[model samples]
Target: MELHRNRGALVLPLVCVLGGAALLLFARDGAVLHRIVGGGGVLLGGVVLAGLLRPFRFAIGADGLTVRLPKLRRLIRWPEIDALALDQPPAEQGRPASPRLLLVPAPGVDLGLPATGHHPRDGRAAVELLDLDRVREKPAEIAAALTRHGGDRFVDVLGLRQAAFDTSDFTVGLRGYQPDRVDALIRRGQDALVWGGTLERQAARSEIERTRAEGLPVAGRGYNTTQVDAALARLSGALTGDPSTDRRPTT
Candidate 1:
């Protein structure tokens, strides 16, 4: 893997420099609004610059590299792997299989994170099946949402019973989202929740993202998009640790 990419090396510094200059330039301007707007610009620029420098995406801990597998019962944490080789998946039931990269283990040493391989397809999507190891740390908020909007059908969220969700119970209002379409999407998430297969969480995540990005005509009456989006986001977060559809990581 390439050690570094310098895309932000120049642009970030330029933004910070320009923003600071603007802040100083407006410090002497008599009109209050100009100073206020300049201050806002400086703050926004600083925030953006901080974000550009924040090492969240580039940071990795000493746990080595953790890779979760399909049907995900276990994770392989490979350490001190210095070589990469391709590993093609064996076809199952006549369907295409995953093409992966195997981190060749240190020979005869056997002292480090165990050698592992993962499908390249994982890096292309939001649902990171093979990724860093970390607990989601939030289940009560999800359970509370299920209790509030899910009604009696959503008795136990951890149980993941699809039949417990009341997809058709939405109340319509002025200038809101299309109810039928939302219900159909909700049913898809329910199916994923019920199946609990290799693609179960992935399916729910896709549905949630699609719903958030979907463009529907404003009806005379329907469900509120904000509320629906929030609920779907929670469900997606419950399924996959990444919550916001808009905030999926880019590499």
Candidate 2:
């Protein structure tokens, strides 16, 4: 596989350069706000330039994968890799979302992250998936290289999940909203008798069962998959108790 750079790395520098120059040049005739903005611009320019010059880079090789982090570079071996996925861009569509590469390892590989190493699909191990965004100009080339080097099988995250979800749904409000925490609210609601605890627990159990059936590992305490799913189910159930008219089944 080849090394690929983020598209933002290039554009960020140009912005820094142009913006900093404009601010510095106009500082004399500027107000207090302009001076403050110019000072911030200078600092931002330095930072942006550094990032642009030394961005987070990844390399695909016959041996394994390598990431050039800001502090230092990390190398991963092939045997450590369990599942690999790539998010390819849309075919001749609107702006492309940045691609991602996920690497799920066999148990006990120690991906260095605290979470369980399950692949996102199976959710078995707390898998550490690497995300790469902002590169769309050479998608096919990147995909081909990744396929050739990283292996052929990859969950096409871009085409599958992204296409399925409406872009409009991802608004500022949604971004700020945490969907995972719906469980706590549901639990609170259950305690308040807004919904029965048994029903909420049943929903959680259903989720736990479904995840287990899919080979996903049991969700542990605190931000665990089970908690999130259970919460969602509880909320769903509360929202649509009467399915005949609701059409949307309650969790």
Candidate 3:
């Protein structure tokens, strides 16, 4: 499935290029013609940029993940990915949120997602896997899709609620999960943030298994059962692609 951001903005650039072409062909006045040509060149540049950028999207299919950069499109098979995680760049306090799908490169292998469309090396020493641009869906949704398709190679580095994943927030609430236990699980999830070795990966899977098998303990006036359980189930789905059947809400 191809996940694309809305393409409505492309229309303005298309119109500019078309209108500029018309003026370039017909305008006869010397001074007027110069200005028209200049404007048309600028518009044409925008048109090219928009056209090239139109391919910047996520293409997930049975074979693997294809992340199309502004100038390059990379097709990475499932095994090539080291870790698949999601991040929402922090925004102004009350502004709208923008979430990005981040891919961590494997130990020594490269999956072909380049840092910059213009530069060859991208000037970064670190290995780059892929970054899915222009994701208009909820970050959770994208994460879920990756988990479902990524098979055994994929690891959820961001845990369940990436937008809400943090150290401080999970601290002891009047009515919430055990702080110590939850913290340990969060730490395990963080270990996979950048595709740790086998032990780290095993630990991440272990936490998911434990969370799925045995529910967390609740202290006096602990976190709301429904809320906490629902959150965990969502995380479970994003991690295992087998969300708790009992926990899911039905129509």
Candidate 4:
């Protein structure tokens, strides 16, 4: 599967270009400060546009995975990959948190990518730290693809239980399910998946059913109903051990 850069990321560069053009149009004649500001904006926007326009050469193939840079291209075979996991570093300053892909090579294997740090679970050194923010595919889609190809080498560090809730990416609307109630249910569902027995799982399932039957209190600007329901469906499938459900092996 070939992954492409997110088109949403192009917004900033486009804005910069427009702003630069506007400044250039409004600037008084022979105004050096205005000219500098306009030129800087255009130049910065152009640079970012060029970088984004570069082809995304990340792909999964029959033999291995391909990573392409401006001057370097390498294929990391399946045997060379020890484990692959997705990590979310804490948000710094005011920026929102973004997911990163951790590719840990097997012992004594060098994939040629720079090592950012060690994996949290096994303490194995990771060769590349890939930012998924600019990638168009959802985290779940990427995980599914990698798990299918990488086999047991793909580790779901971000538990599927939690991911069911986190990956919903629900939209806020004028009236929808209550946020706190939904969050509480998600936590209970996660607990069931992680540590609960059959009875607990059944109970969680029942609670979900009841919650849906009773309908969560609709508040102004809450999660969209469609998205929340989709997430709940996935959670229910996971609780029931549906073969189609995606989950980490308990062992």
lDDT of 1 at 173: 74
- Residue 132 displacement in candidate 4 (angstroms): 2.0
What TM-score, computed on C-alpha atoms, does each candidate reach? 0.29, 0.49, 0.42, 0.62
* Candidate 3 local lDDT, 82-140, one digit each (tens): 55545433333322234445555556765544532211112123333333334456545
Collision pairs in model 1: 173-222
| RMSD of candidate 4 to true structure, Å | 7.1
Stretches off by above 4 angstroms in model 3 are: 19-50, 53-57, 61-63, 67-75, 90-98, 112-138, 151-251
State in Å the error of residue 86, model 1: 48
lDDT values of the candidates? 0.45, 0.49, 0.52, 0.73
Best by lDDT: 4
Q: Which runs of model 1 end up more than 4 angstroms from their true locations? A: 1-169, 241-251
- Winner on lDDT between 1 and 4 is 4
lDDT of 1 by residue, 36-148 (tens): 76667667677766644544221122333333332323222333333332223343432223333334433443423443443222321112221211222223343344244
In candidate 1 the C-alpha lDDT for residue 99 amounts to 31
Cα miss at 2, model 1 (Å)? 70
Candidate 2: stretches off by over 4 Å: 6-8, 55-57, 88-97, 113-118, 124-131, 134-140, 150-153, 159-251
lDDT of 2 by residue, 1-251 (tens): 54555666666666765776687777776377766776677677777777656666667777777867665367877777766755432212222334556566655787665543344344444433444554433545555665666674445443333332212221222123232333233333332232234554456445544543563322222234444555445444553343233222111
Could you give the C-alpha RMSD of every candidate to the true structure, in order shown? 18.5, 12.6, 13.8, 7.1
